[model samples]
Target: MNKNFIIKKNREGKKEDVPKKIFFKTNLFYKEKGFLKFFIYSPIVKEYAFYTLFPNGLNLFIYDKNTYNKYTYLRADWVKSIDKMFFHIKGNIIIMSHKGVSLKTEEIFWDRRKKKIFNKKYTKIIFHSKKMILYAINGIEASEDLKKIRLKNINGTFPVK
Candidate 1:
């Protein structure tokens, strides 16, 4: 519902709209929907192994540090295992991988927050909020269509600047 949170934080300057302070393992991320819908998904810890379902319906805590190629689908078995281990969270906030697509959007959301599977989406010029993680679904039922942040070696953009 707001854009202030999306402003890149200036390391040298004071950061606004962001949490007062984030610990080494603290989960931090922002979420937003079509236009006015907004929320922040803050994980309990810095475990990137946690799984996220789209549309804010599911939450999984995985610690395997496992990943697949871009645009790959999230199998039901994988989703089930993630659910079974929804508490083995670990790591430094593992983020979703686009699988391989290089596109910028403004419509990211963490859908189905009540389920064990997470769905997400991307858009352009949506709102902004402080969240530790986001789960969303943009009218899609498969994770393969979700263009997440991919790994560098997988022909995706590097997280480093």
Candidate 2:
């Protein structure tokens, strides 16, 4: 058998590779207690035994807990769900908030439980309201809503009012 196969025991006591489930142009929505929490759209998605992979690209939209309004938007060239509460996002990652704040990075890790996104890579943050741009060489930690942010080794420019 090929090494890439996910071997499993068949009914006949024979080893077989577990079939992978794949979908194209997929849209998934999550809800909690009848309230819509978030939505995920992917050009292509693959389901393995332990993880879900988005090979092409994915867009995520999170909704406000109370108002049910759009809170944040995330886009990435590739994404992998490490588990139920954590995801690995990579390749031209962009996160935006409804409040006109945006963040750009090559990679990041998102924690659903904490509602946080973090990375130890080059990152750029733009605040449209303040007309400022910030760059972080060492990386950044921020809330999903882009309200609270922490940047490491930061240098940036702000327009003087």
Candidate 3:
């Protein structure tokens, strides 16, 4: 399989007929495990400074190396009201993927309230369906524990590879 993929999002809808340069300029930094070098050559840069990606479409997470603050994982499209104005996590998911990707996957989001930066406890907004709230909580615990173990191993000078 070719380890390369790119897509351009725009307000004018899909620009399927235009040249790729007119939209996005993508570079493949690592073709093996899907590391990417993405650059926007379009007009979106004139507006918002953030973008989101689904975990299935994820290359590398911007979350802290030792925390469960992957805001990207919490924005699945199936859920409702996941974003807010004062501060919220919102991103566009890959609704339709060519490969075996889930349309319900969420885009990554990390919106910090003005106070979040200076707050006593820096926190990220987590939204979930009433039924899935427990699942989300369990995920957080498991991720925190796993991160601790991974961090301990690395601290022991274990090989990263």
Q: Which is superior by lDDT, 2 or 3?
A: 2
Using all chains and alpha carbons, the TM-scores for the candidates as numbered come to: 0.20, 0.85, 0.19
What pairs collide in candidate 3? 72-108
Clashing pairs in 2: none
For 1-161, candidate 3 gives per-residue lDDT tens digits of 32233445678877432221222222222222353322111121111223222212222222323333321222222211122222222234322111111222122222233212111111222122221111121111112112211111111112233
The C-alpha local distance difference test score for the whole of candidate 1 amounts to 0.27
Candidate 1 residue lDDT tens string, 44-128: 3211122332221123222112322222212111111133233222222223324322223232223333322232333111112
| Ranking according to lDDT, highest score first | 2, 1, 3
Candidate 3, run of 10 with poorest lDDT: 148-157
- Superposition error at 52 for model 2 (Å): 0.8
TM-score rank, highest first?
Answer: 2, 1, 3
Give the range where candidate 2 is weakest over 10 consecutive residues by summed lDDT. 1-10
lDDT of 2 at 71: 71
- The TM-score of candidate 1 is 0.20
> What does candidate 2 score on TM?
0.85
